[model samples]
Target: MGRTTIGKSNAKIILIGEHSVVFGQPAIALPLPSVTTTVVMSQTTHGQTLSSRYFDGPIVQMGQNLAGVAALIQALLTRFDAQDTFFHIAITSDLPAERGMGSSAAVAVAITRAMYAYFQRPLTRDLLLATVDIAEKITHGNPSGLDAATASSDVPIWFVPHQETLQIPFTLQGYLVIADSGIKGQTGRAVAAVARRKTAFAQETNAQISRLGQLSTAARQALATPDLPQLGHILNDAQQQLAGLGVSSTELNHLTQVALTAGAFGAKLTGGGMGGCLIALCPDRVTTEHVKNSLLAAGATDTWTEAFNLEEEHQ
Candidate 1:
């Protein structure tokens, strides 16, 4: 590489569809501008190495959890026809690992961008996502590609398996309050569990999955109409389905309940669940604060807010 290169990617949240998306259901993935992951690349005399909180050594020696990153680096080098390339990759991220905030996917996205930039190769959005998915497959056994897509996009997205993603116009008249439950989320385990649940209770499981898909469809229409309350209701309904599917954890459920009790229009766990973050829909900035405080009081490690708008809507 000629000089140091930097690549950045923001976090993302699955607005509704989760496990169901893997089964060909539509999903909404929203970008979380509050946090981000940045990867820095520079020349190194030694062989390829990675520096991050989780590991610091040769890329090949990284733990199983980081296999995706290692694989991405290998794949990138091979693509560049520089197998003997030596460089250092350093990752710094505000996106907490295992919080359903797309940490792994963001990292992979950042890495791919940096690699492409350092190689002086043009990168397209399609190429970027495809490259990142290479790593995602290693990290998440059967990822639906929502994380990579949303993490790289600036706007919200409507996602479906084996289909091109479409950006959804953003317009809502409320706020979103997100809180971390302070425990590592086992996305792999949660996804596998859902698969087992589907096998053990095919009919019921399929029904819930279909319900989540329906809710997603409704959510899209609600967003188009800019119906905040209706959107919140959809989120609440989706949460119930997720709970029935056995993915929600006690901490997540309690936090979501605390938000609802605090007057959130609706609330639910936002990702693979089992232990992660919960998102609450608040009617205004005032309610957003209340929900944020309530989640913290209910044991949330941190909180964030996203506002659709406060300006009066003709509706």
Candidate 2:
């Protein structure tokens, strides 16, 4: 029997820029350490098998939904020259799937790291990202690569597809409340809808995309000075642009409104929208609690709070 190897990755949320990032626009993504995915690997007498909440069986015969992971395992084995070896791969995650929390990317990153650890090999950041991108492609056709990049990183990231990822430095002084709407986000469908709209209204859609890109750029500057109000304003502007793109749903809008009414500095729908989570900026802990309670009262399925400080996050 071989020694067990483990790898872990945290989920992520898009603070600004979502569908627009697909068209060469910058976007910001924050790592969510509060949620995570873990992969464990161990040698086995039988062929390669997978154990997870979604499915459990030989890798070769996994369902279509798991094909990306199956291909990832195959690619890793080939990269390590261990195609003939046998192992059992087990996956566990706290991040909810289909909630626009980068669950798929987290899983891919964790599995890639575990495979490298199992082979007793060093994994570089570049290599890890490239490997994860392969899996991401299979899962999300023509992904922006933001999810994979953010999932593999700890700090907040500024990403533009096919460009070098920049780590934005900032001190967080307030609280962020994330509320899930209990509706699964249809990212593919949303992406398609945006594409159709872009084609139909080329000039208008391009203008909105350009505006979102600008907001992200400004938000990055605001983060440097740690301006919570400015950041909140940027979030609000981005949410309006997203709604114009037709990705925002009634539930998401309701949650954002509830948070804002409850004294949030700013509120917006995060991620792919159409059915996902909304994030609210609170000036302090007290406001965070108040806004959280309000969101629940307004029908939020779940709410989680994240407090950010430079000292704590950097350390």
Candidate 3:
């Protein structure tokens, strides 16, 4: 049989939701056009084994990520009755793991897509998303499923855990400067911290997360109306809530404030937060550059900006 190829899935940045999403709160997620992972499968002479290659450098393993991914693949193979199938799968991506980006989810989605194609099974977005969710559990223990959903679909989604999902309209189209801190934050550790805090202030924490979900819904309307100021306010509010969750670090807070002070419409830490990247909302390229420079000046180790065009679809 001929080699099977699948489309790549872009990495995601949780603009306004992270820890709160785990608590059944709503959050807005956007797909970045900058980084993506692809998987290609072909028959091999040897028995089943998965090989991976990163686009930038070596594939670094974190929190048993490699083993988890391998297990996911094995399960998929078993389900397809291709247990003994010999195939070679390669991956190339710019998304760095442990940087708060949806690196593992992207890998899972890409691999699942490739496997489905190889088996010549009817593929659906919903099925692929489900596979990614299971794969996520192996990495993060209890993921909110937002990462997998965003990575698999590439649409700007308003994710409310245990609630109906909404596709938010993009009103303010501009650039989003996403810069990494080069700091490694294990999702397991971050989740543990939140769990500890929950033990202390269970009701208060739950109430804050509930408010955050409501704010996220309001933010969606702001985005729909292209209200930059309102959107910025919502992001700032969400950041404060996440801070209460104990996910925001000193460095993350510093980065966010710097971006905001430098004219970024909105700024906050994305992902698990303890240490990762901060996203800055800008109205245009000029504002984005201004914020990017400010981020570097404010002790940001690495900073970059990406334009958010509504017409441009991420795959």
Candidate 4:
């Protein structure tokens, strides 16, 4: 038996550039500490196993949805020369699954960090990201690695797949209202849907992708300039493109519209769309509350607020 080890990671949100990132487009994302995942690894009296709100079983018996996790555990054991060891990997997370909050990536990151700690081995940032991605590729086919990167970082970033992630300074004066639409955002299905669209309607789909990419770039500038209205417009435009790509669901659109009608400067689906949370950029605290109330009344299961400041303040 060995000492227990714990590893944890914060959730993340893509501010702009979602599906297009897979096609080499740039994206902006930031870590959200409001939600997180914690992994605990310890010597188990029983054989190798997993424990979480989602499942509890032998590692080998993990369902198809958790194949990435099982693969990560095996890979870690093999890499750290602990294949002969038997332990239980327990995951606790506040992040809502399939809400485009980087739950899978955060869990993978926590697991990798915990396993490395268990082995008393040094884990470099480069190795940590690569290790987490081994599972991300399985959970999210053709992932841009943005979620993994943001989950591990302390600041916002301008991310491009296969390129260096550039940290950005963010300190806007307002509130970012995030609301769950009471549905799972099927990222795999959304991604595959976009992929099919890209193949069948290359010109049209690529145009939408290109537009989203451009909006991400413009969004960066808007944030730098502290242009809240411009940022809101950019978000609205990006939502239109995402909807055009058929990733946005009726729930997502309705919630965003509700936020807008309730006096939000702008709002849009934040994650994989189809069925996930929407983010509303409110002009002030009062407007933020209005947006949140509207979302909840419109069937949002939950909501959180991240204030736009140099220091991340949660409400």
Top TM-score: which candidate number?
2
Clashes of 4: 0
lDDT of 3 at 229: 80
Q: Model 1, stretches more than 4 Å misplaced?
A: 44-47, 192-204, 308-315
Q: Count clashing residue pairs per candidate.
A: 0, 0, 0, 0
What alpha-carbon RMSD in Å does predicted model 4 have with respect to the real structure? 2.6
Model 3 pairs in collision: none
In angstroms, how far off is 64's CA in candidate 3? 4.5
Which scores greater on TM-score, model 2 or model 3?
A: 2
Error at 196, model 4, angstroms: 5.6
Against the true structure, candidate 4 has what lDDT? Answer: 0.88
Query: Could you tell me the lDDT of residue 150 within candidate 3?
Result: 80
lDDT string, candidate 2, 1-315, tens digits? 578999999889998988888898988998877678999999988798999999998899899898789889999888889999989999999888888889999999999999999999999998998899888899987777778888888779999888858777778687788889889887788989999999999999999999999999998888778899999999999989999999999999888988989999889888888898889988887798899999998899888777777243311
| lDDT, candidates in the order shown | 0.88, 0.87, 0.77, 0.88
Clash count, candidate 3: 0
Mark the 10 consecutive residues where model 3 has the least summed lDDT: 54-63
What is the lDDT for 69 in model 2?
A: 91
Clashes of 2: 0
By TM-score, the better pick of 1 and 2 is: 2
True lDDT of residue 243, candidate 4:
92
Off by over 4 Å in 2: 310-315
Worst 10 residues of 2 by lDDT: 306-315
How far is each candidate from the true structure, as Cα RMSD in Å? 3.6, 2.3, 3.7, 2.6
